[model samples]
Target: MTGSVWLVGAGPGDPELLTLKARRLLDEADVVVHDRLGCASVVQELPPTTRLIDVGKSPHHHPVPQDEINQILVRGARAGHRVVRLKGGDPFVLGRGGEELRSCREAGVACEVVPGVSSAISAPASAGIPVTHRGLSTGFLVLSGHEEVDVDQLAATAFTIVILMGMYRLPTLAPALVAAGKDPLTPCAVIQEAWSDRQREVRAPLSQIAVESARAGLANPAVIVIGDVAEGV
Candidate 1:
């Protein structure tokens, strides 16, 4: 009989942040296929007999493409292995969990998603910035910084804007928001490696955050938050 697949979220690089379900699944999985951002401590918890596969990707470098990863998951399930597809942050929040789920179903595999805390919110929260607050932010928006997005629309929203994978594009993104009518002095912050011991953060106005982040030597895998909520503790 074929086995099942579980798309588990490892939760923003902090093992303690993992849900009980995710941790239990990790312990029970016969094989764990994980991404680069997965918590080291959590991955280390796997039994010695559990098979491991690394499919981590870096900016502009995909050592294992998505198609190949999907194939691997399908193959593992067909082989009757209880497969765990471990991802950093919430699988549904820009983790491509939906795509993987669709692939598994197409291949006749039984699969389930176990949600985890997303870095989009947790990163900023770790820096003491609330994404929303009463009378401050009524809502929040999350966007991927990897593609061309409309800064004008984003600037026009009343929601706090959170950008994941945005470190590399801060120069263009910051200026675009300003040009789109957002206040140049709008509060902004960048948080790197949130929830980890090496985590770092930088706060500044919208116009200067890109420059401030550069001075701090922030890199990818960081989250950028913009709006009044960014100014709050």
Candidate 2:
């Protein structure tokens, strides 16, 4: 008798941010597999009898590979245990929830998704900035600031650009944006460890973003926003 899997989003880093459905799933889950960002807080809500598996993936490090994670969910479900696959922020928002969902479907594991507030919007809000304002920003774009980022295609898009997991690629991005004819003085901001009390925000223009970020010593799990919307904060 195969059990089911719940693909739950733990929401940013706050346990209180979890949905009621997610909370219920956590309490009922016999086995929980979680990411590094929201795992610590989620575990605090679980009963001691529940089993916990740490599959946290941090920048420059992957504690558990994706294949292993897929297998864990399938194996646990096949063992007739209610499995919970937890993630930070929105599971589908760069969290690879899509991949996990594909694997589960292929293995015939029943699955469900519980949405959570993504750090993409919440992170900027923590700094008092709005991704979209009445007049400041008509819309915003979210992109990965990684080396593989398509600077040309991204620049062509008119929405305010937000980059995730791109701290290490800031140097390349800054220059690319400028070369694409974007205003060198366009307002930019980077928020580190967003949504946490220790969150740090650094604001600068496109030309100075890389330099400013380096000087501020911003690290991974940070979010970058490029547009006039930042000034509206």
Candidate 3:
């Protein structure tokens, strides 16, 4: 009675953003291992029979470590339960789906990946800013704000820069860009909780994004867009 595992993307913050396959998998999953950023509506709708495991992690804290999460998935499958590793954003895009996938394979558990819309593009669009706009930007770069960011590389690129999990680093992001040769007046926008009711945005010059974002009291689960397309709100 051994079961299988699914690495499903829950999309940004909105439940409606979920793919049909993701919804179908959720309905069939006997166990769901979710993150803190996963949509509440989706989690709340799971049948009472569904076993929910909250392995949500934040920048400063991780209630469930990665090793434990991997073990939980493998153990659940071995016990004959359909397991779903529910993550926010696309599983491959900074969601750490790769590690979990490798874990399942090593444990001899069958696994499948279902992709979802990434917040890197969705968050900016939620604010009417395109990551790449004809003359505005021909390309874009997505980076992690939770770890070491190469400010010099960022300053040298004209490509639109989208940074995820950057709220805590906002205070230094802009100043570093300036020091690395980026224009102080470069347009920047911070989108908080994209596609949800709590969604809010802060638009400012590169030099002022930190102060403006602070004034707005923007918190985690945010996307920071830097480019001409994000200018003027």
Candidate 4:
């Protein structure tokens, strides 16, 4: 009688933003494996009897590799424990929830995904920037800034571009967008620690966003919004 695994999204750092289903799963899970960006309040609210496994990873630092995380989930389920893989933001949106699900299925473990609000939209909205508006933007693109994405190609799109985990890459990304024909004066905003008490935002033109962000001493765990929507126009 193998147990099941639940891949739960912790939303954008706000405990209250957690979905009812996610909260219920957290309380009922026998073991919770969480990431670094998970809501602190929710983690603290876990029942004392629930086991916790911290697999948090920082940029360029993976203390618990993804493979190990998958193995941990498989083992927990095999032991007949209700396991929850809690991730920041929507698990499916650049959180690698799909990979974890595949791992579970391969191991014959039943898995479920409880989606939560993604920072791609929630982060920008917290700063009063809608990802899309009637005339500002008809649609938006959500991308991970953790890799070598093609800013040039992305610049050609009319949709608002929301970049997650891109604070560190802004230096190159901002310039690339400008060089790729995006208006140098296009508005951009960087929201840090979205939905948290220490949340802050920095707005600038696409060409100067990297400089402004540097001047503000912005750190990781931030989202970057590029295009007209960032100006809240």
How would you order the candidates by TM-score, starting with the best? 1, 4, 3, 2
| Tens digit per residue, CA lDDT, model 4, 1-233 | 79999999999978899999999999999999999985566788899999999999889999999999999999999999999999999999999999999999999999999998999989998999989999878999988888888767898999999989988889988888888898999999999998888998999999999999999999888999998988874
Model 4: per-residue Cα lDDT at residue 164: 92
> Which model is ahead, 1 or 2, in terms of TM-score?
1
Number of the candidate with higher lDDT, 2 or 3: 3
Taken over the whole model, the C-alpha lDDT of each candidate is 0.91, 0.86, 0.90, 0.91
For model 4, the superposed segments whose C-alpha errors exceed 4 Å read none
Off by over 4 Å in 1: none
Q: Give the per-residue lDDT digits (tens) of candidate 1, residues 1-233.
A: 79999999998988889999998999999999999885566898789999999999888899999999999999999999999999999899999999999999999999999999999889988988889999989889999988888877888988999999988899989998999999999999999999888999899999999999999999988999999898865
For model 1, the local distance difference test gives 0.91
Collision count of model 3: 0
Each candidate's number of clashing pairs is 0, 1, 0, 0
lDDT for model 3 comes to 0.90
Model 1 poorest 10 in a row by lDDT: 37-46
Give the Å shift of residue 111 in candidate 4.
0.5
Task: In model 4, state the lDDT of residue 6.
Answer: 98
Across 1-233, the per-residue lDDT of candidate 3 in tens digits comes to: 89999999998858788999999999999999998785566798888999999899989898888999999999999999999999988999999999999999998999999998899999999999989888788999999888887889889999999999988998987899999999998999999988988899999999999999999999888999998989732
Candidate 2 weakest lDDT stretch, 10 residues: 142-151
